[model samples]
Target: MSVFAGHRLTCIRGQRVVFRDLSFEVNAGGLLLLVGANGSGKTSLLRLMAGLLAPAAGVICWDGDDVRRDAETFRGVMRYVGHLDAVKPALTVAEHLRFWAALQIAPGSPAQPEVTTALEAFGIAHLAELPGRFLSAGQRRRLALARLLLVPARLWLLDEPRTALDTAAVARLDAAIADHRRTGGVVVLSSHAGERPPEATVLNLDDFAAAATEAWGWREAW
Candidate 1:
């Protein structure tokens, strides 16, 4: 089983100390949900796990090996979905998914079938021919979430994954997450929604903010 852990993680963005000495762990088949007010380091924490940012102190490890030693290799096993949608304006829905799917294919990966399956998973198969410019906010978000199904990755780091998703779309997202977990995939996501994947473990960054020192003029941890 794979284990992803942050030991004594202290994150400082700019001059502000977002959080400090935070430690957490996620194993295969588990879900870790990060919840907090703005600037409480939810996105920052996710970025760290995604290997996009390094901690000022402590270490991030995978199965006891330092991720920094080989961040590229570590990222190969992880998928990061940030706040911004990287969809292209000119690409049709099918083309968009195909582009991302092609990027992750190994030497012998069956590429075409994966793209078709991913769109169907998000219920966007009907929109396959529509260009990105024609989709609604909810549809775009659904497309972004569908990207997760395009390739096999053990860790999924999502930032506010429920944003702009309709009720039905959110249900699809939940189902996709459940399927991933069943396959020993670990997930860490930040969300404000009341409904979440069943059995997900919570890590409220709000609890960490309350324990922070106010001397630094951090002005209410965001």
Candidate 2:
């Protein structure tokens, strides 16, 4: 029963507090859906879980060990896909995946098969020989999502992953997520598109924002 948990997390950017006392937990083979309005700290929360941004207060733990203490190991077992599509205009789709695989996969493993499988999973196999510069917005997004299959990570942190994806691509993504969970992987995602994964636990950032403001006895002026 591997568990990834966050306790009483408080996120602050510069002088403003984004969310406070937020907590969540996801067990192996579980999915968490982050729901909230824009600027409600969904992205910040994902970044916090990914260790890209340290929490102002609280801890994120993996199987009862504090992630901050073994940041490298925690990072190695998780992948964070952010809002931007990280594609290089100069590299063909296959090249880009191969480059990432070289960094993520074990030295002696056959990464090419994994690369092709990932592209195929995302329905982007046909785009493998195409330069990133020529890809449409949907194609580029699929290319970014395909990285999830390139490596075996325990946890996935995705921010707005469905953006720019068509119906078919979205279906492929949902299927990929389901398969990952079946293999004891965990996923935490934010989507404004209102698409929900089956049996996902929902956490609303707006609740945290309201609670934090009331706890502090302050309100922002409009």
Candidate 3:
């Protein structure tokens, strides 16, 4: 079993201490949900995990090996879905998936079937020919979520994935997450929704706020 862990992580963004001394671990088939008020370190922590930002202290390790040692390799095994949708105005829905499938899937393998499957998973198969600009907010969000199914990755880092999703779309997302976890995939997401994947471990950034205040004399509230 693989383990992804953060030990004593301290995040400082633009001279503001977001959180400090935060530690957590997720084993294979595990789910970790980050919850906190806006301005908490949830997104920051997710970005750190995705190797987009460096931790001011501590390290992120996969099976005891520091991710920084080989970030490009580490990134290949993970997928990150942030607040922004990656949709392009001119690309049709299928084209968008094909673009990503090309990058994530192996060379020579046909990507159409996988793209079709992903579109169906998020109930967007009908929109496959539609341009990204024509889709609704909910549809765009579903398309973003569908990318998860197009290729296999061990870790999924999502930042507020439920943002524009309807109840049904959210259910699809929950199901997708469940399926991923069943396959030993690790998921870390920040959400404000009442419903979440079952048996998820919670990491509330509120718990780390005090440490940041005390350690850095940061007084402005998040």
Candidate 2 lDDT tens digits, 1-222: 549999999998765688989999999999999999888999999999988899989999999999999887777788888989899999999999888877774434454548989999999898899999999999999998888888778889999988898889889988999999999999999977677688999999988884443433233442
lDDT of 3: 0.87
Q: Least accurate stretch of 10 residues (summed lDDT) in model 1?
A: 210-219
TM-score, predicted candidate 3 vs. hidden true structure = 0.90
- Clashing pairs in model 2? none
- Tell me the TM-score of model 1: 0.90
Per-model TM-score, in order, reads 0.90, 0.91, 0.90
Say which prediction, candidate 1 or candidate 2, comes out ahead on lDDT: 2
lDDT for model 1 = 0.83
RMSD of each: 3.5, 3.4, 3.5
Off by over 4 Å in 2: 105-113, 210-222
lDDT of model 1, residue 5: 89
Our model 1 lands, by Cα RMSD against the true structure, at 3.5
State each model's CA lDDT, in order: 0.83, 0.87, 0.87
